[model samples]
Target: MEMAWFVIVTVMLAMYVVLDGFDFGVGMVYPFVAHTEADRQTVRASIGPVWNANEVWLIAAGGVLFFAYPKAYAAGFSGFYLALILVLWLLIFRGLALELREQVDHVLWRQAWDTAFTTSSVLLAVVFGTALGNLIRGVPLNRDGYFFVPLWTDFQPGAAPGILDWFTMLLGLSCTVILAFHGANYLVMKTEGLLYQRTVSAARILGWMSAGYTVLTVIAVPLVQPSLALNFSRNPVVYLAPLIGVIALGYSLYFRIRGRDTSAFLASSVFIFLMLVSVMFGMYPNILVSTTDQALSLTVYNAATDSYGLTAGISWFVGGFLLILTYQIYLYSQFWGKTRADDAH
Candidate 1:
């Protein structure tokens, strides 16, 4: 049951990344791709109908974490309190920017919101990537299974490490580039004429950059945490996750070059999904690792709630998942195809 919940949580988070990730990518590429007010509107319209709905997956994943793995959830929230607060603020600003950008006709008003949107989006991507890096690199957990990290401590992933280490920063940058690449593909699929051309050009450059950084991140992962590969070594089939991710990334670029916008976007989605799957595969059993002591790490067994709770929650979870899935399908179908600046919400 605990393991099931772990898989459930992983899938939910991965869904959040693949869904809302393009929204973030849109924000990241907005300034570069949007030159005129019409261009900005088109970009906003492309994501306007679905961005908020996409974030529901993140909220649902957090809720499940709190319910299914209360111990790890509590520890992680408290330990990363500052970082979480920052993320919350960024989310708020990004939301406000999206909602308020067209409230007034003033150029300055729209520009202010535009800046906020792009800045918040880029920062959120970096923070999220850094959080993953911290997880992979381990935290300074005590015997009590809780730890606090400052923003930076000599920028190193030592026994007593900070959240913004060199390794985490690298992943953060990589995430930014990858999301930009992802967003470009999405825009390519949703726009026409000059907008599509610009996005295609951006996607081409960002694609190669994302590929390069992915390679660096993959190499750095094993160096930072050798234990992450133990499961892969034992069960070689697990390697397929990353293998598929790389193939998807290659296909995204190939489809982009062939001017197949939808195919490229779908390929980028697959790449993001499979890459996250690889991370989950690498971090199995242990939900949170401890830099202080491996014994203090929170595994699924140690961190899960009572068996009764897990069993009861599954039924509710299934029903809720179905409703959400249906809503998502309907939402996308309604919004399918090219968007125009006049369509901005």
Candidate 2:
């Protein structure tokens, strides 16, 4: 049951990344993509219908984690209290920026809100990417399963790890650029006329940025997680994820250049999926690892609830997921195709 719930939660988290990720990416690129008031409105209209819906996956993932892996949820939330608060603040401000940006007609008012949205979006993406890096790099979980990391300690990858380190920051940057390109591609695909042309140019620029940063991240991963390299050496199949990611990225570039919007966006989603799978596969059974002590590793089995509880949880989880899947399908079907300006408020 614990294993089932873990899989469910992981899938939910991945869904959030693939869905809400582009929205966050859109927010990050908003200021630059939308040069004028009309352009900004088009950008907002492109993401407005889907932004709030995308977040539902995150909420669902958290619910499952809290219910199924209560211990891990408690430990993780408590240990990462500061980071979580920042994430919450980013979400709040990002939402406010979206809702209140056009409420007033003044130049200063619009500019302030746009800046807030962009800054918060960038920060949110970095925090999320850093959080993922910490997961792969492992935390300083002691015997009590509690640890706190400040912004920086030594500014090195593994040397006295902190919330922001060389490795994690690079990963965060990669996430930022990748999402920026993804959002750009999305805007290009959805919007027409001048908005589409701007999106195409932005996509090209951010696409190059994404490609360069992704390469750096790929190189850094094995260097930062030497054990992962060792694991890949032992099991050559693990290399497939990165290989597939490279291929998908190439496809994205080709499709974007060819002006094939849907295919380009699809490739973007695939790239994110392959990259996430690569990280998860590298980390394997360990839910959390200790930077300070190797013995304090948190594995799925070790961190799970007991046998009977897990068994019952599995049944409930499966049922819930089927319903969730049905609803999601219906929702997407209802909102299929490109959103028009008339459709948006």
Looking at model 1, residue 298 earns an lDDT score of: 94
Name model 2 segments beyond 4 Å from true: 1-3
Clashes of 1: 0
| Poorest lDDT segment (10 consecutive residues) of candidate 2 | 336-345
lDDT tens string, model 2, 148-216?
777788878663588888888888888888988888877777787877787898898888889999889
Q: Taking the candidates one at a time, how many backbone clashes does each contain?
A: 0, 0
Clashing pairs in 1: none
Q: Cα deviation of 243 in candidate 1 (Å)?
A: 0.4
lDDT of 1: 0.93
- RMSD in Å for all candidates: 0.8, 1.9
lDDT of 1 by residue, 1-345 (tens): 998999899899989988999999999999998999899999999999999999999999999999999999999999999899999999999999999988899989999999999999999999999999998999999988899998899998889999998999998999899988998999888999898889999999999999999999999998898888887898899999899999999999999999999999999999998888888779888899998888899999999999999999999999999999999999999999999989955
**Least lDDT summed over 10 consecutive residues: which range in candidate 1?**
226-235
Distance from true position, residue 260, model 1, in Å? 1.0
Q: Model 1: residues >4 Å from true position, as ranges?
A: none
